[model samples]
Target: MTYLGEIHSRLLDHRPIIQGETRYFVKEFEEKRGLREVRVLENLKNVIQETNEQILPKCTETMQDYLSQTLQRLQAASHLVYKLQQKEQEQRKLNNQHLLISEKQRITQWEDFMTEQHNKQAAVDEEHRKATERLKEQYAEMEKDLAKFSSF
Candidate 1:
């Protein structure tokens, strides 16, 4: 869903270095509750670039090159992690929206069912009222006839 494929690959390239860095830092510093706070790889990306252009040309040290490569990897991993987090947030929001829509639809269906039942009851009541009125009329007629015939 994201256009961070290239970035993700770049991040993968530095995985080993970042892992080692994390392990080293976490092991080196034990006082902190979390290992991530001991950022042994601080600004490696910046250092790598500066060293490649200035220090690498002058010294040609393998350690410097290695450090640079590791930094580049870390930077990519960091970018990918940020993008993934955003994607997760977006997914959560979308799920919530879907839930809201479903709830509204359910409520509408219930309301429609209630209205239909109410209409049916009203129709039935009307029919019963008419039938009762007709019966009352018939009863009145019978009573009148009996009175005339019986002289009561």
Candidate 2:
């Protein structure tokens, strides 16, 4: 119903007899003039429909291209995220390995220091035992000499 109204309006707008008539009764128009206006409106409608048909495919193709490009970008972003996650995992593993190596080295150094201290303590104990034995021998010789002098 709206389409028919639009067609009628267009016909009235295009008619030469009705161009400047603001107050003329629409029912008073001659049948031949009305027919001519209707034909012109029908022709205009046909031209508009043909133009829309010609442009519809290009619009649809443009929309499809935009969607395709958007999908490609999303796929690329997804791949980048995956690669970043993998790299993070690799870095975490390397850090753990570095920590382990440092801990092992620290333990080894502590063991070496403990062994060196033990060796030094053992040498000091041996030297102290030798000095005590020499002191006991000297005291025994002095006691014998003093006894002989008293007898005489």
User: Count of backbone clashes for each model?
Assistant: 0, 0
Please give, for residues 119-142, the per-residue lDDT of candidate 2 as tens digits.
888888888888778777777777
Clashing pairs in 1: none
Model 2 misplacement above 4 A: 1-64, 128-152
lDDT, model 2, position 113? 90
Give one digit per residue, the lDDT tens place, for model 1 in 1-152. 35587677677678878999999887777656444543545567678889989987878677788899999999999999999999999999999999999999999999999999999999999999999999999999999999899995
User: Roughly what TM-score does model 2 have, to 2 decimal places?
Assistant: 0.43
Model 1 spans with C-alpha error above 4 angstroms: 1-60, 132-152
Best by lDDT: 1
How far out, in Å, is residue 28 in model 1? 46
Model 2, residue pairs in steric clash: none
lDDT of 1 at 96: 99
